[model samples]
Target: MQHDIAYDTAAGSQSITRAIGRVISPIAFLPADAAEFFTPVNTNKNWLSGEGKRLFDLAIALPLLIVLAPLLAAIALAVRLETKGPALFRQTRSGMCGRPFKIFKFRTMTVQEDGASVVQAREADPRVTRLGAFLRRYSLDELPQLLNVILGDMSLVGPRPHAMAHDDFYQSRISEYRHRFAAKPGMTGWAQVNGLRGPTPALEQMTSRVSHDVFYVRRASFSFDLKVLLSTPIEIIRPRNAV
Candidate 1:
């Protein structure tokens, strides 16, 4: 799945588009910073504009959002009744190229923690409200992220975005960790499909998840995305590693 491309660290003045094109070229030269972000090891041949996946995300997300409008309303109501805060939880997450974007989810915890001191959720964590727990277990809390897909901030299948604080910590600890950000974030991802969902309580768990993510980035294609999409429903129903 690997593509061979030349590397030149002196192309710092080129635009990101040019930089990406260079990476795909047989004789490529990229700036040092760009090289760090986009490498041949993680770049796929079918990774052009990704318009097909983007269109697919909108195609499914738009209708699903409309069809599930009522259900979403009900969930919001439940969250509101169960907690003193807003039903929707918005937190900053690192997007492609390490850009910051606010991610949306259903409010699952009693506290809205968006700071550097945010803690990972544990099984039967006291911070999780009863209704919130149900939402999280089924991953219904991620429904709101459909909006993010429509807005071009995410995709239906890719690597999931970590919280800003978590990203900062992991990028420093794992050299390949930040490589996952080359692709746009997703609601469900290769890691999730492979049972890497839920809290990464251990560093090894997070590292394993990153491995799957980098694999997706290298092998990403229209067909591969379809497989991930089709397999997702079965995973959801069976409820493997989800919290």
Candidate 2:
């Protein structure tokens, strides 16, 4: 049950033609919205569509590291002075093709801990510090992920990466959740910009996020990535339904 659809773009255009090849597993039999949409991918041996995305990610991320160096350094210093723990937080996150990679972020919490399971932080959570609150509010906490993008563990735009525990928890609850991994996880994404950011308290919220994630997969392109990037600042400035 695999198919590939390629959308033709203008000549010399740098748009991205998104595709997905479903890899069925016993775990993928969980329930999800019947209204979900998926654009199949051509699994033919001759296809070479992935190179465009990889090239684009590398090009964008390398320049961003240089461009944002000052801001990143300032944020790192701020987190260090405001917290007693390390400045950068690295944690394993599920990424493209269900592979694992360590994601980087500025530590916004007083204490950092890792376990078999992870929990979404809610508003007024005691673990969050005053500076952490500001960082989370404006997404300054995510600055370190620019390095993740540079490292090819993430992209400038796509679905936000989730904790391994959260991914496992939601896989049983939302069938389409795994589809998000069809592409690289992002620093910001359609879900975050369209009001899916922060703590997700219910299955519906997760469903909404997955919906946008899949949508971005189906309609992804360089221009679309730019659109998401442009919208992210607004999302942070006036965060709605965020934790």
lDDT for each of the candidates? 0.78, 0.72
Cα TM-score per model: 0.84, 0.79
Clashes of 1: 0
- Regions of candidate 2 where Cα sits further than 4 Å from its true position: 1-49
Model 2 / residue 185 / CA error / Å: 0.4
Give every collision pair in model 1: none
Q: Candidate 1, residues 93-136: lDDT per residue as tens digits?
A: 87766567799999999898997877889887999988888888
Task: Give the alpha carbon lDDT tens digit for every residue of 150-235 in model 2.
Answer: 77778788789888778778877887776676667899899999988889888998899998998887677767877888898888
Quote the lDDT for 23 in model 1.
38
Supply candidate 2's per-residue lDDT for 116: 71
Give the best candidate by TM-score. 1
